[model samples]
Target: MKDFELDGWDDEEASTDAATSLTRTAARVEEERQALTEQALAERITAAVNAARPGVDKIPDPVDPAGTGNLTADEQERLDACVAGIELLSTATWVAGKSLDTVATGRLFRKLVHKLEPERCYTTIEEWAEIEHGISRSRCSQLRDGWQIGEVLNARGYKAPEGQVRELVPFFNRHGLKAAVGVYEMVVQAIGADKVTAKRLRETVKLFPGDLALSDEDDVNVIAQSLAGAIEGATPPAPKPSTALPTELKREVDRRSVALADRLDRGRIPRNEVLTHLLAAFADERDSRVFDVVFERMKTSNS
Candidate 1:
C-alpha cells in the first residue's frame, strides 16, 4: 500500500511540470507572432507615406554635379528656365509671402526640396525650412499650406483674400477640396468676400454642425479690420530710420509686435511695418492727456 501511494504522488508531480512547460512554450509563440505583426505594420505605414508623395525620388538636387540639377542636358535646360521664371515671379512680388506670387514659389520650393533629397542636402522638412525661409519649420508648414490653398481657391473662382487662405486651411482639409471650395464661394457670396473677416468666418464655422470645426481663435482687431476693410485700404507707411527705445518701451513694443502679427491677415506681418506704425502712433499721441498720466507714473517710479 505504501509503494502504491508513492507512485501516485510521483505521477501527479510529473503532470504538473508538463503543464507549466506547455504554458511557457505557448507564451513564447505568441510573443514571436506579435513581433512579426508589428514589423509588418511598420513596413506598410512607411510604404504608404512614400507612395503618397509622387516624384519625390525622380527630381534631382539642384546642386547635383551632373548639372541642370542632376538632369540630362535638355532636362537641365528646362529646369533652369523654370527656376529662372520662378525667381522672376518671386522677385516681382517683392517677397509677398501671402500673395498669389507665393503660390508659385511654394510649389517650386517643394519640388526643390524633394529634388535635393537625393543629395542629402536637406534630410528633413525642418532642415529645408531653415535653409529656405530662415523661419521655424512650423511657420514654413503654414506658408506651404497657405500657398497651396490659395492656388486651389483661385482655380475654383474664389480669390483667397489676404489671410483668408491660411485661416481656411483646416476648413478646406476637413471638408473635401471640392466641397470646401463650394462652401467658400457660398460664404463669399453671402457676406461678400471683400467684407469677409477672418474672425467672422471663424464664428460662422462654429455654427456649422458637421464637417467643419473652429480651427483657431480669431483676433479682435483682425475681426474689426476685416469687417471695416481697414487693413485692405491701409497703405504701408514709408520706410523710416531705426530708433532705439528704453528697455521698458522696448518690452511694450515687443508685446505689441506679437499682437499686431496676430491681428493681421495671413497670420504674419512685416516687423518693420509694424514698428513704424507703432512708433508713429506713439509719437503723434505723446502729447495727449492720456499719455501725460502714464508718463507721470513712470516719473514717479524713477524717483
Candidate 2:
C-alpha cells in the first residue's frame, strides 16, 4: 500500500471520545434520578403503612371464615367497615397505576410489599414477574383499568354487587360510563336488582336497543322466549325459515342466540328469532349516516 497522510484523524478520534463521554454522563445522571425516585416512593409508602396499621389492627378479625354467627353485632359492623377500607386502598392502587410510568410503578409495587410485610424480603419486579405464572406488567395494566372503571360505576350511583359492576366494565369502557348508567338503570328496572346476575346483565347489554324504541316488555320477552325454548317441546310460535348464510356468519348468529338462552332465568326463545333481531339491529346501523359516510369514503378511496 502507498503511504497515506491521516490528516485531521486525531481530531476525529478526539470528537469520538467526547461523544462517548457525554453518553456516559447522561447514563450516570439517569441512574441517579431513578435511585432518588425509588427512595422517595419507599419513604411515602412507609408513612402510609405506618398510619394505616393502628386502625386496621384494632378491627376484630372474623373468627369464622364464613363470617356468620362468629361476632357480636357491633363487631360485625366494624369488620364490614374495615373490609370496605381495604377495598378502597386496592382501588387507589389501581387508579395510581393508570398515572405512573412503568419504572415508577415497579418501584411503588416493591415499596408497598416492603411496607406491608416488613418481616419478609421480596425479589425485584422482574424476578417476581418471571417466577409467577401468567403474572406480568400487562396484568398490572389491566388491574388499573378494572379499578378505574369500577370507580366510574361507583360514582354514577350504581354501587353494590361488585360482580355486576365488573361484568359491565367492557361496556362502560367502550360506550362511556354515562351511557352505561342509562342501560344499567333500564336493566335494573326491568329485571329487578335481585335477578341481576352477571350473565343476565351481559346478555341484556348485548341486546341494547340503542336508538330503537324497545321497552322493558320487548327486552323481557326476549328473555322469556329463551327460557321457553330450554324446556323440551315447550316451543314458542315457529319462526320463518332463515336463508342460508356463510358458515362464519351463522356461527356469530348462533353465538348471540345461545347467549340469550343462557341468560334467561326462566324461558326459551328460538335461535331464528334472535337472528332476526340481530339482523334488524345491523340493518339499522348500516342505514345510519355514520355507516353511510364510512362506506362512501371507502368507495371514493378505492376509485
For TM-score, the strongest prediction is 2
Q: Residue 250 error for model 1, in Å?
A: 33
Off by over 4 Å in 1: 1-120, 156-158, 211-303
- Identify the runs in model 2 with alpha carbons over 4 angstroms from their true place: 1-58, 62-71, 82-90, 93-97, 100-135, 160-162, 189-197, 209-303
Clashes of each: 1, 10
lDDT per residue as tens, model 2, 186-229: 56666775566778777766564333232233443353343233
- Residue 4 Cα positional deviation in candidate 1, in Å, after optimal superposition: 99
User: lDDT tens string, model 1, 132-228?
Assistant: 6575766656665555455555655554553565566776677544444444554676687777667766655444444232222444233333433
lDDT values of the candidates?
0.57, 0.59
lDDT of 1 at 219: 40
Provide the global lDDT of candidate 1 against the true structure.
0.57
